[model samples]
Target: MRGRFARAARLAALLVLAGTVQAAPVHASEVAHPFTVLGTPDRRDVVTWGASADRTGDAVADRSYRLVVHTSVGGGDLRIRLSNAFGDRPVTFDSVYAGLRRDGAELVHGSNRPLTFSGARSVVVPAGGVALSDPLPGRLPAATDLVISIHTPDAAGPATGHWMAMQTSYATQGDHTAQESAGAWTETTGSWTYLDAVSVRPPTGTAAVVALGDSITDGWQSTSDLDRRWPDYLARRLSTAHTRVKGVANEGISGNKVLADGAGQSALNRLRRDVLSQPGVRTVFLFEGVNDIKAHTGVTAQDLIAGYREIAQRVHAAGKCVVASTVAPFKGWSEWDPAGEAVRQEVNTYLRGSGDFDAVTDFDHILRSPYDPERMLPFFDGGDHIHPNDKGMQAMADAVDLSRLDCAGRR
Candidate 1:
């Protein structure tokens, strides 16, 4: 095995390659069409933090929620999306505020700002729908802890939210969104409710990437609230890189797939809404398919390849690059078998050879064990051999060619 220091050096070299991609010219219409609220094609509302909502249930009425989401890019104006996509009845959030977090449940004094829907102070989101807040004017710094406080007074029926948030957000009873103090927030929840995405209006040229993957991208075994997921690390890298792609939204669900609907909608089905609909998105980082292969659903490499080709083609049609990744090795997991391993090898070969994608990152190369070609390196394995640990997560982030993420190449 190579020394850890040597490995780090080589990994850094790989990232240098990833970050060396040339500036791909973006059309004014590629990103401008989605921002009807601003009434111009110049808004840069890049998604900073996002969670894939799953399994709707009833929501408590007359409750206040202060959800904490981290931002990837900085800008003067901010907008948030509240979803009731899984509900069967109307859900109303009366008092909603956006503020900066100052430890625990406290908000930075005077940083709490109210968010409105359209011109109204409150709005009712119809069942299976989403509501976006009007742009609020302010300077939102990159990598800051943003708190979105919402009070749904008459909320009932199906509730849409991501269950494995990994981050700790506070909850309280009744309306407390206007308060910036911690006194009213006596409850805590691991999952984020109603709130799905937070975006900011950066410079007109700034761009963002949406990472669509499985639990590994969702930070399952990684430390909670630390923003240690691979995509989080990549965002940190992009913060200082010279590339225009400065924003990143992690859309990973715990058990998502590529060809079929399982955890969240299949990557193909949700691509438009979850990845492309957001403003200022320059690329779609597709890192799914492990769940599909490991699930033993009789999916073939050709089936997975067809899925990849479709994703790349659709992204190209949207005039955005699609950077796919080879699935990491998981032969030590309980689902590992010669048949599954064969499928993984075949798929990885395609990922490395198929010229259909704008770019490809061999996650399998950096994550697999030298001793056992098919298993995850012990250093990166998060016990289950499926998810990577914090160190492994960082390594994966380092493997990307940051430059390829912004290419203007067509499929």
Candidate 2:
């Protein structure tokens, strides 16, 4: 009898040391997965997936959408952010459901769950505003395809969504969001509508990195439906590596510039919404300015540098680190010229030596050809020469040092 009691006590002690012993009952929405570091568990919400929102199309009433997005970190109580930032009128979401994608628009059996806003099923998001769903109770695994089904009952006027998503989503008429079947979701779209970000509660110290850039960061040339973007590769690395920053948000807009609004809001204008507003972001990876330099917009190297400085200042004020990347070589593109090349060279030099950023990644060195020095390596170049192929995208992600991402103690 004494030996049995001793063994029981030892088992209890082992559980406590492993941080697996339950102490108190927590609300479903407030629960987190069992994850511990250094014998303690600290849980906080971190962005697992994100896309930048811009004006896309006119809204339709009583329309249902099944949006498929990829996750980066595994955790519980998933929340999603819906955007109306470019809308001229209010939008009402009557029903919203989240589930794991089985195949195409179909969801895993018994995995579809409804999401609410402030205890209500419907949420009315005002123009130029964003609505975050009250977290649904559950654990979401890393690198899984999370399908968000949305039903907009009275949506109208200009709509806000991410264009050039590269991933295929589904749409249909009526409130089919409650159904897990793919029958009603026949229409397919290459863009994600309304939704901008998805978050999950992981270990408290686990942070996320936001990649802010243009077409390359948006995975333009990479094969669609594969999630082969550079940032996606980075997220894969963070998930398996010995690092606390496990989430990655790709805020790249094709043809986007740093100083002006064209394809989407400029990096400076959308910085807060696209980077800082994201939950648990620790670093802003700046990889823009190619569009500005190539457009002949009279934006000098000094002007671009000033813009970078302002971004760094704002990000620092928000208590986050900045990681800037040297613009990659794009010599064979239609807009490439000697003058633009000079500006790019000067900017690259500044990014390498500025000391303003917490760390710098030399994308130029990684993608540029040694023989031609000014052109992208033939093996890595996509057809346009401005963007990279799948191999090059992976290379870019591999160059990022995982250790530099943890900016917890540094000021």
Maximum-lDDT candidate? 2
Model 2 lDDT tens row, 1-411: 222222222221111122222322222311321111112222367889999988897999989989999999877767888888888777899899888888999987667777777667777777776777766665678899999999998889998899899999999998999798999999999999999999888876788999999999999999999999999999999999998899999999999999888898888878877777788888999999999999987889999999898888788877889999999999999999999999999999999999999999999999999998789999999888889999999999999988888766764
TM-score of each: 0.89, 0.89
Number of residue pairs clashing in candidate 2, backbone atoms closer than 3 angstroms, sequence gap of 3 or more or interchain:
0
Candidate 2 global CA lDDT score = 0.84
1-411: candidate 1 lDDT, tens digit per residue: 112212221221100011111112233322321211111222457777787766545788998999998989887567788877677788898999888888988987777777766655687877755677777766678898889999999887778888888899999888999898999999999989998888888887888999999999999889999999999999999999989899999889988999888787788766765677667888899899889998998999999999888888878887888899999998878888889889989999999998988899999999999999899999999999989999999999999999999885542
Question: What overall lDDT, based on C-alpha atoms, would model 1 receive against the true structure?
Answer: 0.80
Cα error, candidate 2, residue 170 (Å): 0.2
Q: Model 1: which ten-residue window has the lowest total lDDT?
A: 12-21
